[model samples]
Each structure stands twice: as C-alpha cells, then as structure tokens.
Target chain A: MKELEDRIRRDGTIKPGNVLKVDAFLNHQCDVALFDAMGAHWAQLFAGRQIDKILTIEASGIGIACVAARHFGNVPVVFAKKTQSINLDGDQYVSSIYSFTKQREYPVIVAKRFLQAGEHVLLIDDFLAKGNALHGLIDICKHAGVIVEGIGIAIEKGFQEGGSKLRKEGYDVKSLAIVEKMDADTGNIEFATTD
Target chain B: MKELEDRIRRDGTIKPGNVLKVDAFLNHQCDVALFDAMGAHWAQLFAGRQIDKILTIEASGIGIACVAARHFGNVPVVFAKKTQSINLDGDQYVSSIYSFTKQREYPVIVAKRFLQAGEHVLLIDDFLAKGNALHGLIDICKHAGVIVEGIGIAIEKGFQEGGSKLRKEGYDVKSLAIVEKMDADTGNIEFATTD
Candidate 1:
C-alpha cells in the first residue's frame, strides 16, 4: 500500500473534471510488478476470506485482476464485459453502470456460468469515484447470488463519495491510494494518509 | 504447453466460424495459474531476447499479457485500446483491424508515449486466425519504431494463414497450441504438433 501510494504521488497528475491520470503506469501502460505487489498486499489483507473468484470490468481492470489472482491462490478471474460480443451468449447477470468520466450509462454483464451461487467474490478496479461501477458489480454479484467478500481498488478519489458510501455500507473496501485533494492549476495532489 | 493443449482439448468447444471457445480458462473466465505456466514457457522460448515490453490488445489479451509479463522479468504491459475514452488523449499509434469472427473492421489505438522507439516489444494475444490483429499490432510497433522481438499466442488456428504468414515474414512467432483442424459437427480439434 505504501508503495502504491508513493507511486501515485510520484507519477499521477491532476487535471480538469477531477481526473487523476495514471496511464503512465496504471491503466494503459501497466506495471505488472506493481500489480503483483498490490495483489500480494490484497491477498494478505483478505487472508482467510475464502475468495473463490476475482471480478473486474473490462480493458483496464483485467491486468490488475489477473495479477491479483496469482496472489489469491490462482483463483479464476471473471471480468464483466461493458460491450456485448458474439462470443457472449446465453444467461447473464447484467447491471447498468453510470460512468462519471464518460458521462454515460452502460451495461456490464457476466455469464451466469462464471459466477455461481454462494461463491465468495472479490471486486477489483483501478479507480472508484462515485461508487457507480462498484455498485454495479455488487448488484451483479447479488443477482448471481454470490457473496462479495471485499473490494480492492488501486486508487480512490477521496473527494468523491464512493469510498465513504461503501464504507458506510460496511463493505470491506481496501484502496491502496486515496486522493484526498487535487489542485489542477498547480498540479498538487494529496493522499488521505501519510503512510 | 502440454498442459495448455490438454486443457484446450478438455474445455475447448468447436463452433461455427472457426471459433475454438476457451472462454472458460483463457478469456472470460481466466485461470491465472495456467497463464503463469504459459508465461513461464514463453519466457523460456524467448529467453535472451531482451524484451522490454509486452504489447497486447484490450479485454482478452490484458490478462495473458499481465501474467506473461511476470515471467518476462516483470516488464511493463501496454494494451492497445479498441474504443476511445475521455482519458485517452494526445498522440496515438492507430491501426485498422478486421475481425473475422465479428465480421467487421475496427480501429485499435495505442498511446504514443508507451511504445518508445528502439524498445524491444513482444506481442501477446489469445488467438491468431487471419493475422489482422497481429498485423495491426506489428504496424503500430513499426510506426513507433520498436522492435518486435517475437509474438506469443495461446492458440493459433493453423488452418488459417495468420501464423504461417507471420512465420514466412520472418517474425519469431511462438504459439502454445496450434489447431490444425476442427470438425464443428463432431467437436473434434487437432493440434499441429506434439512439441
């Protein structure tokens, strides 16, 4: 967690629309070493929780989820698809997610065969702003009758209500870095904790 | 490689359009353990190649690329984006790829900053059929002035011309499993080699 927070402080940039750009290492160009470390940290934090599967959204979350799955005893990772493909057919657990960045609502779906009933799942993602995506994942898990053991996030926007809202709901949400404040004009960023 | 081929023989379903569905382990529901093994095998195959990066496309390729990066000495994995997002801005290396399965042509873009000139990149993907996506990636790498040390594929449709074409063009293409033939009616799949 310290390493992640440190990386965020070093490489992350603040921009307009309350965006923290980390494409240099987090999203587009991924550091698998960092992801491995983060995965080990998450595995330790959620030890003995019986996480049967790791769930994430497409494109961005796939790398982190896969790397994290290594630390979770090589559990299978099932990513929710934001777009429908010909390969995806039959029964599905679908949920609508509102994107704060894209300013649009899209559907996220997972094959019902992947998330079985009574399985314990861990939700992982890159960022949590308004908890819309996380909430959508939770809804999908609920619909599939799977128990969400916890949520792991690389970075959370502390200025936003997502993290707090999930915490209030008593979800075991662990975020490596929380951006408490950001000054776009000055390019100054602050983390929630010094550690 | 044997493990991968065995898993494919067990779980892979042959369908119309030359589709060998390994979604249970390779794509939708990913087994990171198997990916780790495949990564290790790829690392050995491409040993001493001095690969600085692992290049892949979004969604399916991200997991394999991330897992494989660990074996490639924890190199950075950069996945090209199929769809543009608000976060993606500035100069980009773009290519047009035709998907035989989807029966459409779409654009794949990689941020210019990620793929540096003279960097050694290894392209990794889930499948190779018509070489459209692989060619697009090679084109992107060519535009960026990077050396593609080799290409790693989980499965290659040997019946198709993609893998053979790349080999003929002098690329170090290594596929874990190559399906020489598939009978959709009988659901029989055959790999090209015992090696």
Candidate 2:
C-alpha cells in the first residue's frame, strides 16, 4: 500500500474534472509487480476469510483481479463482460451501470453458472468513482444468491463518495490508495490518512 | 504445454460453427492456476529473449498478459485500449482491426509513451482467429519503432489461417494448444502435433 500510494503521488497527474491519470502504472500500462504486491496485501487484509471467487468488470479490472486471484490460492477470477456476445451461453445476471469515464450506461453480465448460490464473492476493481460498476457487480452477486465477502480497490476517489457510500452501506470495502483531494492547476494530490 | 493441452481436452467445449468455448478456464471464468502454468510455459518457450514489455488487448487478454508478465520477470504489461478515453492524453498509435467474433471493425489505441522506441515487446492474447488483434498490436509496435520479440497465444484455431499465416510471415508465434480440427456435433477436438 505504501508503494502504491507513493507511485500514485509520483506518477499521478491531476486533470480537470478530478481525473487522476495514473495510467503509467495503473490502467493502460500495468505494473504487474506492483499488482502482485497489492494482491499480497489484499490477501493479508482478507486473511482467514472465505473467498470462493473474485469478480470484477472487464478491461481494466481483469489484470489486477488475476494477480489477486493468485494470492487468493489461485481462485478463479470471473470478469463480468460489458457486452453479451453470441458465444456467451446459459442464463445471465445482468445489471445496467453508468460509466463516469465513458459517460454511458451499459449492461454488465455474468453467466449464472459462474456465480453460484451461497458462494462467497470478493469484488475487486482498479478505481472506484461513482460506485456504479461496483454496485452492478454486487447486484449480480445478490441475484445469484452469493454472499458478498468484501470489496478490494486499488485506488479509490475519496472525494467522489463512492467508497464512503459503500462503507455506509455496511460493506467491507478496502482501498489501497484513497485520493482525498486534487489540485488540477498545481498538479497536486493528497491521499487520505491510512491511520 | 502438455498440461494446457490436457486441460483443453477435458474442459473445452465445441460449439456449432467451429467455436471451441474454453471460457470456463480461458476467458470469462478464468482459472488463474492454469494461467500461472501457461505463463510458466510461455516463459520457458520465450526464454533468453529480450522482452521489455508484454502487450495485449483489453478484457480477455489482460489476465493472461498479467500472469505472463510475472513469468517474464514481472515486466510491465501494456494493454491497448479498445476505446480512446478522455483520460488518455498525448500522442497515440491507433490501428483499426476487424473482429471476426463480433463481425465489426474498431480502432485499438496504445499511448505512445508506453511502447517506446528500441524496446522489445512480446504480444500475448487469449485466442487467435484471423490475427486482427495481434496484427493491430504489431502495427502499434511498428509505429512506435519497437522490436516485437515474439507472440504468445493460449489457444490457436489451427484450422483458421491466423496462426499459420503469422508463422509464415516469420513471427515467433507460440501457441499452447492448437485446435487442428473440431467436430462440433460430436464435441471432439484434434490438436496439431507439436513436434
């Protein structure tokens, strides 16, 4: 967590509309070594817990989820596809979520067979903004009658209220880095106190 | 590769229209343990190569790429974005690729900063049908003036021209499992002889 917070401080660029561009090591260009470390930290945080499956959205979340799965005893990582292809068969649990970055509402679905009833699911993602994607994954878990173990996030936009709202809702949400405030003009970022 | 071939034979499903659905382990519901094995195999195959970065497309390709990065000494994994995001800035290398699965053509963009000139890149992906995605990635590397060390694929539809064509073109394309033939009605799959 210290490494991640430090890396974000060094590489993260504060842009207009509260955009923290940490693509150098977070999203587009991934630092798998850092991800492995983060995964180990998450495993430590969620130690002694039951995690049957790790669920995340497509694209950005898949890399982190895969590395995290390795830490979780190599559990299967099930990513909810953003689009339904003809190749995807069987019943599906779909939820419509608005993407703050893409600025569109799209359906995220997981095959019914993957998220079985009574399974403990751990939701993971790269960044948590308005919480639409996280809630969508949670909705799918609820529909499948799976138990929500907790949520693990690489970075959380603390000013956005998504992480706080989830905590208020009584979900155990763990964030590696929380951006408390950003100064776009000065290119400065302040993270929440870990202690 | 024997472990991968055996897993494919056991868990892979053959659908109509020559579709071999290995989504249970390869894509949607990913088996990270199997991926770890595949990553180790790829590391062994591409051993003693100059690989500075591991490149792949979004969604399905990210997991394998991340795991493969671990085997490649935890190299950075840069995934080309399927969409040009507002957060992505500066110069970009874009390529329009046709997807046989979705039956559409779309642009894939990689930020210019990630793929540097003189850097050696290794392209990794889930499936290779027409090689559109792989070519697009290769094009991005060429545009960035990087050296493509090799290509690693988890599964190749050998019956299709993608794998053979790339091999003919003098690219080091290593496929863990190549489906030479598939009987959709009988659910039988024949793999090409590795030796």
Q: How well does chain A score by TM in each candidate?
A: 0.96, 0.98
Best by DockQ: 2
- Chain B of candidate 1 achieves a TM-score of 0.97
Cα-based lDDT at residue A47, candidate 1: 86
For TM-score, the strongest prediction is 2
Across B1-195, the per-residue lDDT of candidate 1 in tens digits comes to: 789999998988888877788889998999999999999999999988989999999889999999999888898999998877789888999999987756688899999999999999999999999899999999999999999999999999899999989999999999999889998899887888833
Q: Which regions of candidate 2 deviate over 4 angstroms?
A: none
Q: Model 1's DockQ?
A: 0.78
Supply candidate 1's per-residue lDDT for A137.
92
lDDT of 1 by residue, A85-180 (tens): 778877989899888766788999999999999999999999988999999999999899999999999899999999999999989999888889
**TM-score per candidate, in order?**
0.97, 0.98
Please report, as a residue range, the 10-residue window in candidate 2 chain A with the lowest summed lDDT. A186-195
